[model samples]
Target chain A: MISPSIFVFAPLASAALFTALMVVRSRNVIHAGYWLLPCLLAVAGLFGSLEAHFFVVVQILIYAGAILILILFALMLTRDVMDPKQRQTTKFAPLAVPLCIFVGLGGALMMARAPWPAIQAAAPGPAEQTKALGLGLIGDYALPFEVASLILLAALIGAICLAKAEKEPAAPEPVIDLRGEIELEESVSAGAADGH
Target chain B: MTANLTHYLALSAALFGIGLYGVLARRNAIAVLMGIELMLNAANINFLAFWRFLAPNSVEPQVYVLVVLTVAAAEAAVGLAVVLNVYRSFGTVNLDEIARLKG
Candidate 1:
């Protein structure tokens, strides 16, 4: 009989692998970005199977939701994403097939030789896992958590500044136009009053 | 024929290998970033698998995964921002074409 885990994990894993391949292989940049969505969601599903409930939620919210959107925006801003002439793979791409086989099989063989412990599967109650992860974040990992938030804040500001810099020079043009319009309106009002 | 720790390990290894291939073979900056994201996911899978099979009761690995996710998000944001900057300076996002410093 096929195990339930197989039924769930197989599809998710295959979907992830397929989408990841599509993400790198698609000629259109926008299509590549779109392919990232399913890849991320499948990884999130894998996290759920591992009983990392908090991570599953976070993976979906942050990776699939936020990061993918950010990437899409970048693609739209940076490239003519619909252009079919864009090159998808480099000259070195053909090497990837053999390298992937060698590396993957070699790593798997090495791992198969390791003496992994026969510990119990993580069957932690989902609620308990979430609560424990929360407490640990606040209680034990608070310093790292704070540091991570600070880094994220810095990254956020840095990205904004980087993306905003180009628009800064052109910004004065709009302001100057607005001021001229205001002055023109005031002159029109004065003329109307005199006429009245 | 049940799925065990070794199976998860193999899967993670395969994913990591594929990610490495993507990283090395892709010319587009955004595609390279996608490759990096896949690599991070592979690492996260390893973390969770090890946590489940080797240290089933510990919450430490989960904490590490959380940190990884934060760093990954930050990396993505900064990476895409840089990609945008590059695109503005150069009319192309291809890494090979952006070699202005090649003295």
Candidate 2:
């Protein structure tokens, strides 16, 4: 039977599914970016259900607010945000059915007996949790954080290099014909040169 | 009236399944990124679910989820930055066509 929580999570789940499909199947990349908003918000609701109030707020702010907007900007930065032409990649038909069955069964059964653990050893309150996180980041996991930053730096440099590399090749933009529809394929990458 | 772990699990499962569909079916790189984000969010829900239903007191998962949040932010920033370059070079966002390094 459905509970009141169903009233909330149900719509959230449906929104997530709808937006996800839109994001995948949408012809326009920029349009897909806009559709991501609802999917991220649904995930935020899931976070709320998990009792991570902080995560819910943060997901909204960072994922839905910042990241989605960034993606939209990136899509817009390219010239072709609204080409109604449908492009073709390999038909994504055969794989969808088996994948759905596998993921559905795997996710459900895998989570069925998932050891939902809660530490009763020490009752760390929310305030203490923040304190612990700060300590862990600075004291123990500082290296990993720094490492991630370095990787990001590398990606930044790589993006820059890629943008600069092919100033010479000078090939016109590659246009893809999906189902006989021409779609312009340009990299929104800021760093196309270095990696190239 | 309170949602339980099963509720979170079902939600997460659905999310995961959707993500799998996206990763498999979508050809655009950015759309694939969206799929990955969905998958991560599903896992995050699982973390918070365990924390709530199983623990209900400690905030370690909460902290960890925040860390994951930061990581996801970093990833999107960097990944999109790279994708921009990928698009510029290849002129196509289809993952299959970007196989220049396939040598």
Candidate 3:
């Protein structure tokens, strides 16, 4: 008899693959960003099937929620973001063909050759898994947990500083708006000629 | 047929390769970041599969997955922030065009 999980895994995996393709191939970047939603959700579903409950939640919350919003925000900030004529892929994309072939073949070969241990028929229950996870985080892995938090703190500060607009009396705008300056100069010259 | 360890490994490998193609081929910086995220997910899949098939009793893999998730979030945040900064100074997000340091 076919395992019941095939019903879920098959559909979820296919959807994820489809959305990932859309994310890469779509000319419209916003559409690609939107497509990322289903792909991420599908991955979460896969995590759930593996009985990684906490990861499934975090995947939905962080990947599907926060990261996606950040991407959309960045996309919106970009000028001509919705332009359909924008090229999504580089000319060097063809180079990926050979790389992919090599990688695929190598991965398949490795999977076939390696001897994986036999899997147990049952997954640990959610409560037992969560308890063990909590104890490990608080006990043996405490130092790493604290270090990870510090890294996150540093990342937060770095991101804020990088994205923040710099203020200085020497320059009103650090980034010289060249297009605006050119337009202003043209208008001023045109006015001078008209005055004469 | 059962959804065995080999099956998940195969799927993860496929996803990883696709993500690699995306990172190498895409011109948009954000799209490149998305590709990186995909690769990370594939790695996470591999971790979970190994945990389930090899050592279901240990919570080490789950903890590792959590750490990876946290790192992925921070990376995305910082990456997008850098992208925004680049956009501000360069006025474009096209990686090919943002070659100020090109020799």
Q: TM-score of every model?
A: 0.85, 0.72, 0.85
Candidate 3: which pairs clash? none
lDDT of 2 by residue, A59-178 (tens): 899899988886777666553523547552247646785786578667777777766543333334556655766677677677665775676676566546654655676778887657
Error of 2 at A129 (Å): 4.4
Please give the lDDT score at residue A181 for candidate 2.
37
Mark the 10 consecutive residues where model 1 chain B has the least summed lDDT: B1-10
- Model 1 clash pairs are none
Candidate 1 on A44-77: residue-level lDDT in tens? 8888777677788898999989989988888878
Model 2: runs farther than 4 Å from truth? Answer: A1-6, A79-84, A113-132, A139-196
**lDDT tens per residue, model 3, A1-196:** 1122767778887888788878878888888889989999999998887877777888899999998898888888884643658677878888996896578557856886787756764667788888898999999888778878987998999999998986544745578889999999999999999999
Once superposed on the true structure, which residue ranges of model 3 sit more than 4 Å away at CA? A1-4, A79-82, A168-196
Using lDDT as the measure, name the better of candidate 2 and candidate 3.
3
lDDT of 2 by residue, B25-49 (tens): 7667777777778788877877876
- How far off is each candidate at the interface, as Cα RMSD in Å? 2.2, 4.0, 1.8
Q: Candidate 3: global Cα-lDDT?
A: 0.82
